[model samples]
Target: MTQALPSLKDHCRTTVAELIRICQDRAVRSALRPLLAGIPDMQIRAMRYLPRNAPVNQDLLYLIAGLVAEYPCSLPEPNNVMSFGASLYKLSQHPDIKATGIERRLESLLQLELDSLMQPLHSLVVQFSSTQSSKTSIVIDYATLLYHLRCWDDSRKWVQLTWARDFWCPKEDGKEQNSDETLDIVKS
Candidate 1:
């Protein structure tokens, strides 16, 4: 028989110290259901990249930071770069996040992720969209993601979410390359 899990309250405790480690696994422990954990790594890391750390609107910065400092996106090394950016784009809009910290870091990460992942995503979108859509289908558009990020003018925020894919891209010198991409949390 399997043992029971921990409580949700026991999981999410906002602290920069834990951000680095929890980033490896957004969902450390869950009871029987879903629970909010830590800040998305991409957003936190993104905060590191902002050219201008100036607060967008004082109150909002802290709020966003608190949220960023709290979200938990445990994506793997490479693919996570994009996943975190996207997660932040959504989270920046949250009222709590806006009241907390710098949105620029999140913005910068988003931009960076998109810049690197776009062409590949573009091709993927083209190929996938061409196929038939099932009753339940999820579509992530890499194009204009920055535009979407900028739209965090109201209540929105990125949270600890995870996604996976098998994306293929060309080598820097134009050679075709494909890898079995897993977005981090692999259910072993």
Candidate 2:
């Protein structure tokens, strides 16, 4: 009998818990600080938490791990419903946020190709962390971030569309409003 592989959500949940543990340990966090600087070659410290030769995008995984290490947060949402997009939406609505700044940043991020995504994304995640730090602890869905990164290269750019919807279509009465319109606008 063969063992079944865990789903991405399950894998991410486990990975996130490991990342939180790293964040809590000063020594480990210090060792992994290089990852926050986008050190591509010095991956030995990060290698232990990563899968061994899995048929997955290692670059994206490393990027996510680095981001999580840099901005430590507890995963308050359930793994299945955790959403980077939703967090961005909440950030956009933050009272301290400058709406136009976030709008422009998100627009630029959506236009970037996979190769150019890391730096801008790092900046935005940092911004998200800073903006929320004073009022509430920073929270982000690492699983959703990884999933979106993997899907970023799809021809239709569905991940981008979904992000735009999450940002623009605020929920009302326990449902999303004008999400279809937001998606259509994103498609053009």
Candidate 3:
């Protein structure tokens, strides 16, 4: 009989921890200082304590990319959004990971998880379009995420939807209050 391997979450935790340890050397820090200078110290500390069994998300992916980018070791490709997406696409094509068994592809699982997270925002957009409430903030937040993710088409769709319904304006004391900071951000 063969022993079962650890879960993907466990594997990811171990891999990240090992990578962090490798980058802890003085020489490595000096080299990485320029690139990592913009990242907060709190976030760096939090990386050390990432829960081993927790589900992955975009934030975790960003942190992992940041850490991987700073490593001096050679990788098949640079640690950037394109390379990350390519790696995920490659993983999605694997036979075992693609098999409809107990274990699914990591990319597929992550995509499903992300879609679930976005569902609430989609619902909020639909509801606010009809009701014109303060919940328009959710649509703004969703648009911002899309912008950062480089989904320009979807981001524009949300911005257009919000503008079409004039949801950016809030009625205050019988006056149309139109001081939405997010509107400025989304427009640019």
**Candidate maximizing lDDT:** 2
What tens digits encode model 1's per-residue C-alpha lDDT throughout 63-141? 3233322332232233223432333333333343441232434333333432243333233223333332434222232
Regions of model 2 farther than 4 Å from truth: 1-5, 48-55, 172-188
In candidate 2, what are the lDDT values of residues 20-112, reduced to their tens digit?
A: 766676665565556656576657776765544433476776677677766777766552343455666767667877778878888888888
Better of 1 and 2 by TM-score: 2
1-188 per-residue lDDT for model 3 (tens digits): 99998754344445454445545565544433333333555446445434344334535433343433333222221111112222223322344333232123322323333334333323222332333233311112211222323322353543333422232232222111223454455556
RMSD of each: 17.8, 4.7, 21.2
| TM-score of each prediction | 0.19, 0.76, 0.23
Candidate number with the higher TM-score (1 or 3): 3
Candidate 3: list runs displaced more than 4 Å. 1-62, 65-83, 99-188
- lDDT of candidate model 3 versus the reference: 0.34
Which candidate, 1 or 2, has the higher lDDT? 2
